[model samples]
Target: MKIDIDYTPENKAVIHSYMRNVAQGNTAGAAADAAADAAKLYDAGSATVQVNSVVKAESEAGIDLKAGEVKVSTENQTTTNVSTYYKVPNDGKLEQL
Candidate 1:
């Protein structure tokens, strides 16, 4: 049997936030809460603003992984280049990518 899974950008962002909090020694509930908060904030803003915020927060928090850092490999494509990467701090400000 073949199983399919749907992972949306929002879902991935939530998971990423949770994992990051957990890695920083936050409890599961705390991590979930933080992720939820981040998601809500992101959803309230425009796409450009949202992306900028995430990146800034990650950078200020010393997070190694920023949004759009990972590249998806295709069967036929050997490589991919991310056009831009944003670094937003947790201070709730939007920075350029």
Candidate 2:
């Protein structure tokens, strides 16, 4: 969940101004500190959803993985029927995944 953000010049200028308001020493140092703190927060919030959460959502939507492929139903929460699978070997994404 590492982030690499290159702030546009205009945004960087605005951030420098804002950070200068509370700090007394070097303005660039203050802005770098602020950016570092923001990166930590951004990393913390940027995590892949837990496997259980994904499983629950897929279960609720009646999507299942079988034979190394995905099978979905026309209606949410309905049972899967092999004949109705939308994306398959003849259709793609399962192989891509």
Candidate 3:
């Protein structure tokens, strides 16, 4: 799984600060910061969850992949829109493009 995030410097600073606060055991502060950042990013349309495939096994073990678009679940938050992408490689396995 991979996610690409592109945001303004202020948002990036907020994320960095949130991580630091979490690492420093500031749970209350981190939680508030994370919630705020999540809302801001959601409104700004600056986050993307891009997934290629779901790999189930190693290639040596006859790799099997459930190839399809990924669905993101944001509980308690309504999504205005979502873009789904479908892709399948010729090998029938998940390969990074």
Predicted structure with the largest TM-score when compared to the true one: 3
Relative to the true structure, how large is the alpha-carbon lDDT of every model? 0.45, 0.39, 0.46
Per residue, candidate 3 scores C-alpha lDDT tens digits across 1-97 of 2323455664677557646665777666467877776554444333333443342432222334587555443334233333443223112233333
TM-score of model 1 vs. true structure: 0.24
- TM-score for each candidate, following the candidate numbering: 0.24, 0.21, 0.32
Q: Which stretches in model 1 have alpha-carbon errors above 4 Å? A: 1-25, 48-77, 81-97
The lDDT, on a scale of 0 to 1, for candidate 1 is: 0.45
**Error at 92, model 3, angstroms:** 34
Which candidate leads the pack in lDDT?
Answer: 3
Per-residue lDDT of model 2, residues 41-76, tens digit only: 333332222111111123323445565655554423
- What CA root-mean-square deviation does each model show from the true structure? 21.0, 18.9, 18.0
Q: Give residue 88's error in model 3 in angstroms.
A: 24
The alpha-carbon lDDT assigned to residue 28 of candidate 2 equals 68
lDDT of 1 by residue, 1-97 (tens): 1112224664566556655776788766586688675564454333342211122111222334656354443333233333433333223354456
Q: Which candidate do you rate higher for lDDT, 1 or 3?
A: 3
